[model samples]
Target: MSVDTAAIRRIAKLARIHVEEEALPGLAAEFNGILQWIEQLQQVDTSGVEPMAGGGATALRWRADEVTDGAQAERVLANAPEREGEYFSVPKVVE
Candidate 1:
């Protein structure tokens, strides 16, 4: 796909970039070059290439799934300026 100066201006506007009128031609040429390179890449054949998960074949380690209180009540509420028993107290907003 060939890119023109008008297309470059539209792209700049969509990206919210402040590109000058003089720079549009140069930018359009650069964009067209990139598209040409991508088209060249598309011509390569990779029929049966298996995708790789990572650089190595190491298995990831996982911990047991369990739920527990994040902290003891006193420790959890220690920094509360105004707390009611085991919870932080806030001003009631509802009527």
Candidate 2:
């Protein structure tokens, strides 16, 4: 597929990008090459292939879901600019 200067200009206008007249031909050719590559990709056959989350063969490692105390409240609040008791104090936004 071929893309002309006019089409390139229209695309540039739609994308809100400014393209100079001298650079329109190069942009058009680049767009045409990208479209050609997409067209080529359409010819590949993958009827029986299963879609994969990643390219690797190993399954995702997972840990047991259990609730546990974080045990670092005072240490975490130590860096707070304003704190009350064991919590960071922030300006109230609502009544």
Candidate 3:
């Protein structure tokens, strides 16, 4: 893949990066080198390689799924200036 200065300019615009006009040629050449390296990587043989998880062969530990309330509502509502039943109450500011 050939990366010309015009393509580099377009890429910079899309990525919201500021590139000096004189630096476009250098950036284009760098991008072309990267694309060529990626193309080379695509030609490698991976048919015999097995997919592996990032955590390796070990099974991950998992905790039991349980449901229960935190049961601290009274403690949480202790600092309220005004509360109606179980909720905080605020002055009405609109009709």
Compare the candidates by TM-score and give the number of the best one: 2
The sequence of per-residue lDDT tens digits that candidate 3 reaches over residues 1-95 is 79899999998999999999999999988999999999999999988786686644768789888886568778877999988877889999999
Q: Where is the poorest 10-residue window by lDDT in model 3?
A: 49-58
Q: How much is the lDDT of residue 64 in candidate 2?
A: 90
Error of 2 at 51 (Å): 1.3
Q: Would you list the rank order by lDDT, best first? A: 2, 1, 3
Model 2: runs farther than 4 Å from truth?
A: 54-82, 90-95
Clashes of each: 0, 0, 0
**For candidate 2, lDDT tens digit of each residue in 31-81?**
999999999999999788876777558588999998865789888888999
TM-score of 2: 0.63
Point out where model 3 deviates above 4 Å: 54-62, 67-95
Which residue pairs in candidate 3 have backbone atoms (N, alpha carbon, C) closer than 3 angstroms, thus clashing?
none
TM-score, per-candidate, Cα-based = 0.58, 0.63, 0.57
Q: What lDDT does model 3 reach?
A: 0.88
Candidate lDDT scores, in order, read 0.89, 0.90, 0.88
